[model samples]
Target: MTEPQVRRVRLEEGFEVQAYIYGEGDETLFLANGGPGLPSLYLREPHARLARDGWRVVAWDQLGCGASDRPQDPALWALERYVAEAEQVRAALDLGPVHLLGHSWGTWLFTEYCLTHPEQVKSCILADGACDIPHLVGELDRLRSALGAETLAMMRRHEAEGSIDHPEYQAAITILNYRHVCRLQAWPDSLTAALADWNMGPYGEMQGPNEFTYTGNMKDWNRIPAMGAIAAPCLVLCGAHDELTPACSEKMHAALPNSWLKIFEASSHMPFHEEPEAYFPAVRAFLEEVAARAAVGGLTRKSHPCR
Candidate 1:
């Protein structure tokens, strides 16, 4: 696959967001990455394949992460800003009617964007999806608790002492992260770089200090009630061992009238990294079906809400 070209796409907000563009296919997939603050490069595992397999893909850092601008203003880290940022990126690039895809926290932004701007979407993909922030945090809490008493105690002690950066705390988090985040024997360098480059400005203010906590502004964010507003055919992707959980993806599938669900049984949150054998094939098939549907005409999204 060709290397991603680092490009600048100017948003409506009059600021340019850094992005990586790959492939030259007619069908463009706009990626909304996870971590309200994570660099978008981790997406290369799944997306680079899409580009090589004949699809145009655009993955970018949202304002404050990766190669993107880092203004350090907390006021710019709200949920709405990211949603608007996605819209601006699409518009500035003139990437007409893309197959919008989001992973983890990115799913929340994708959902809200589709609801508000249904006209710009050809299809939607939610990978390792989460619908309610409270539910997400609760699930995270359970995952942390299941990590055994000693590890949990170490993590909690560090949190209580405000020593989240303590080596003990970091070590404990790695144990938990290895279980639910990647499950790979060794993490890919891209994912490693993403963690190293994670912008605390956006993460701490929006997603919290770490994955198991949620003291940020998104604690009450819930988009289930607004699922009907998306009005676009969707693909819900999740791992059986996912921290986001299959239930989260199922909730979206049930609510979305024209939606399908795929679960990678052997993987967790980062299925692309953990279960590429299943993850990539499933995604390719879904996109193929989407392409076939588009060739015939367009997806007729359901007009009613889930009851």
Candidate 2:
């Protein structure tokens, strides 16, 4: 299979965003990362597979992460701003009515974007994401408790004081990230490399001192009520062992009018990496069916409150 070509596009404010495009096909798939500020490089592998399957896949770093411009201003980290950025990216690439696949935090932004711009999306796939911030926090709490009181206390002390830069805090965060986030004892090279280049500037400012804490702008953010507004056919995926929990994903699936849920039995948060054999085939099949339906003028979306 041909390797993806890395490219750049200039947005409205002259901000340059980097994107990797692979394959040549009528169907365009945009992969959005979760960090709100995370770079899109972590999505490269999945996009590559999607491209190899006859779909054009575009994955880009968001404004504050990876190869994108990282402005020190915290205002650049808002949810709506990311939504606008996704829209601009789509328009810049001339990818109208595209299929959107959002992972983790990216799923939140994509859901908001889809709710606001239903007409611009043909389909959506939310992988290991949550519809409620409280639900996410609860999951974190459960994981912390499972780690035992002593570990939980240590994590709390650091997270409370914003001392995530401390080595102990880093160790704790690593444990949590590995356990529920990726489930791999050691993060994959692609993920590790991406993490190494992570612009913690924005993450510290927005996502709090670490992943468990939620003093950020997205703390109380819950899009559960807005799920019904999403008109596109959606595939909600969750890892059976994901920290986001299958319960949260199922809630989203139940609320969405045209949605389905799939649980990768042996995977954790990153199903694409953990269970690529199963994840790729499932995604490819869904996208193909969606494309076929659209070709027959069968996939139609309805306008809802958020739109």
Candidate 3:
């Protein structure tokens, strides 16, 4: 694999973030990783491999994670601020109307950015992402419910007592993670590293303590109503056993005016890691379709949405 070239890009309030660039091509695929708080490492490494296929791939650490400057101001963690910051990063790098890929929390940010700044987006890929937080929370609850009445009760007790770090509670979460988060008996090193160094400030404030809970500011957020207005060619990718769930992807797919949906049957949240042979090709095909469409003038809402 080729090494990515890293650079420091300055954001508002003088905050600087680390950006990585792979390959060199006219068309760019910009990445917005999940975890409002995770570094770009996990998403960057795998997708960076896509650069070999003749497209520039760019990814960055958000304001307070990875090698980015971590300011202690709580005010900087808002979605609106992050959206503006994403725009700044694109503008500074001079990547024109990139193919945007948002995983996990990044899907929320990129979806909003796509809506607000349509001209700056060529296409969008929402990987293991959902636009309805309330619905997503419900899906999470359903997944947890499979642990049976006894385990659920213990989890609830720990949650109520703010002992989520307790062994029993963590053990329960571990099972669900193995089943829905990645499904691989052993997680990729890049993913493990990203989680190891994860910054939980924005995560806790915006998305709660863990993947299965929704006590954050965005718990009630729902963007489905506005999804129909998104004009960019979009691809919605999710695993059957994803923590975000296929139902969430289906909902987003139903609302997006110009989009395609792909569900990896035997995988989970991190399908790119769990089923890369299938995942990468799906993504590559989508990018190829977008590029081909762009070549014939430009894409339009009238264009047939793939599935």
Candidate 4:
């Protein structure tokens, strides 16, 4: 694989976000990553195959995380701001009608962006994402219970006291992450590198300390009811054992009129790494199907057919 072309995109005067462009293609895949804060490093390999197939995958570390400029204001971490950052990146690069893909919290960013800028996206892929946070929290309760009564108590105690760094707390959450987040015995080097460079600013303020404990500003976030607003062809992807879970993906699939769901049976959150055999083929087929329909003139909203 060739080194990505790094470009600085201006969000506003004195503020520029770092974006990495990988591969060359006629179709553009603009990726919005999760973490609400994670850098784009963990994403390098997942989309490389897409690039090889003539899909230019563009991913960026949004402001306040990774290699992007960190802003001190908490107000800067809102969903609206992230949407705007994506728009700015699109404008700076002049990437028209991209096939947008988002993973985890990035899917939320994709949802809102596609809702507001329907004309900008040709199609969308939401991987391991939920349109309902409340439903997700309820699922977390079930998952935490599976961790045994003792571990649940320890996690709750640490969260209440704000001692998120406590060893016991870390231990419990690590179990949660290991079982659901990735489920790989060995972490990929790119994933480790991205994790090492994490900035807690945006995450703590938006998604809270960890995956299970989402006490941040987005706690009440739920878009399932309003998913009808989305106009693009959407492919909803989720793992059978993902923290985001298959049920969450089901909600979005049911709500989006022109959408379908594909499950990675033996995988968790990061299916690209966990089940690349099934992962890439499913995604490639979906994108190709959408592109093919588009080449013949896009679908009409009156019919709004599901794929």
Candidate 5:
């Protein structure tokens, strides 16, 4: 893979966002992380291979996450702000009609951006994303049951009492998050470091005490109706064992007019990390198909063509 060149751009609001760019391919791909607070560093390994395979991969830390300027005002961290940040990054990089990919919470921002500016997107990939928080809450409840009442009760009690700082509470939350989020036996160093640097202040104030609970503004949010309005070709990916589940993503695919669904058999929430071989190929194939269609329709430059 080529050496990654990191660039920092100042948004109109004076917030500096960092982006790591790799490769010189014509196809520019933007990857958005979940956590709303999770840095883009954890996505490095997954995207590095994409860069090696002839795609210009750009991963940026969203505001209040990673290396970006984390503002104190909670209002500045909303999904609308994030969508604007994404647009700013795209414009700053001059990456027009780019392929957009979002994981988990990032999918919310990506979906909103696509709906609001479909013309700017060439294609979209939503991986392990929860389109509706209510639906996600139901799925979390099912997983909680399988985890047994005792553990669930303990988790609830700790969260209710605002004891997230307690080591035991942290441990319990970590276990549950790992299982449903990444499904890795142990958290990888890159991911762990990113998590360590996460702006918990923002996460707590916005997303509540834990991942399962929804006390934030997005609690009752549902984008099912907006799915039909998306004009770009979309690929909705889910792992067989993902907490988001194939059924959830398939429902999104059904609602989208121009979309496809793919499930990775041996993966969970983080398919790019859990099943790189399948995940990368699937993404490349989808982008290629979109590029081919665009080429046929004379929508893009032939000189700087996509593979």
Candidate 6:
């Protein structure tokens, strides 16, 4: 792959974040990766391949992670602030009518952005994410409970005591992660890099201690009631065992008026990483269909991929 051109875009007067631009095409794909605190590396590196197909791919580090400025202000970690940050990034980059893709936490951000600024988006991709936090918390409880009463009790006990760093607790989390997060025996370098530099400040404030926990400011956040108003054609993708859960994707798909859903049977949270052969093609097809529709000034039509 060609080296991505890195650009620093100012979000405010003095605060700037890094954005990686790939290819030079008429159509653009703006990516919002998972992790309230992760750099855009994991999503950028893999999605950059879309550049080869004549699509400009743009991924950025949000305010508190990656190459972005990380201030100590706790108030800046809110979802509303992040949504505004996304708009600033789009405006700074001059990405016109982008095909927006949000993975995990990015999906929550993506749904909110589209709700707030529908005119700027050509289409939406919600991958391995949920828009309903309360429902997601319940789903998470279900997933963790599958570890049985003994393990679940231990996890709860540790969580109650604020001992998540304990080895046993972490070991349970690892097992759940293996089953529902990546499902890959070995993770890709890009993913590992993002994990290594993860800024837990924003994560703890917005999401919580780990992927399975939801004791953050956003734990009660839900956009399901507002999803129907999003007019952009949407593509919802999830792995059968995603931590976000396929049920979450289904709920999103059902709520979205113009949308389609796909469940990757052999993958988990990072289907793009776990099943790229299937993942990339699905994303490309949806974007292509949307672009074609825009080109002809036709109404957005649903492009269904095999379930």
Question: Residues 1-307, candidate 1, lDDT per residue (tens digit)?
Answer: 4688778977666677898889889999999889978888888555788887889899888998888888877899888888888888888777898998899888989998898789998889899978887777778877888878888888888888888999888877777777778888988898999989888888888777877778889888888877977766788899888888787788888787688788888898898888888888878877777787776765544421211
Tens digit of lDDT per residue, candidate 2, span 90-169?
88888878999999888888999999899999999999998898888887788778878898898888767867678876
lDDT, candidate 3, at 5: 87
Give the winner by TM-score: 2 or 5: 2
Residue pairs with clashing backbones, model 4: none
TM-score of each: 0.91, 0.92, 0.97, 0.95, 0.91, 0.97
lDDT of 2 at 287: 84
The TM-score between candidate 4 and the true structure equals 0.95
lDDT tens digits, residue span 179-259, model 3 = 999898889999999999899998988889999998888899999999999888888999999999999999999999888
Candidate 5 lowest-lDDT run of ten: 298-307
Candidate 6, pairs of clashing residues: none
Error of 6 at 231 (Å): 0.6
Where does model 3 exceed 4 Å of error?
297-306
C-alpha-based local distance difference test score of model 1: 0.83
The per-prediction CA RMSD against the true structure, in angstroms, equals 3.3, 3.9, 1.5, 2.2, 3.9, 1.3
Model 6 agreement with the true structure over 1-307: per-residue lDDT tens digits: 5799999998774788999999999888999988999998999898989999999999999998998899888888899989999999999888877889999999999999999999999899999999999999999999999999999999999999999999999999999999999899999999999999999999999989999999999999989999999998899999998999999999999999889888899999999999999999888888877777776664344334433
Q: Model 1, residue 291: what's the lDDT? A: 80
lDDT per model vs. reference: 0.83, 0.81, 0.91, 0.86, 0.80, 0.91
- Assess candidate 6 and give its lDDT: 0.91
Cα RMSD of predicted structure 6: 1.3
lDDT at position 25, candidate 5 = 90
Error of 6 at 265 (Å): 0.6
lDDT of 1 at 153: 85
> Residue-wise lDDT of candidate 4 within 1-307, one digit each (tens)?
5688999888863677899898878889999888877897787557866788888989898898877888788889899888988998998998888999999989999999998899998999999998788899998888899999988888888888889899988888898899999899998888888888888889999988889978889989998888898878888999999999899999999999888789999899999889999988888877887777786776443433334
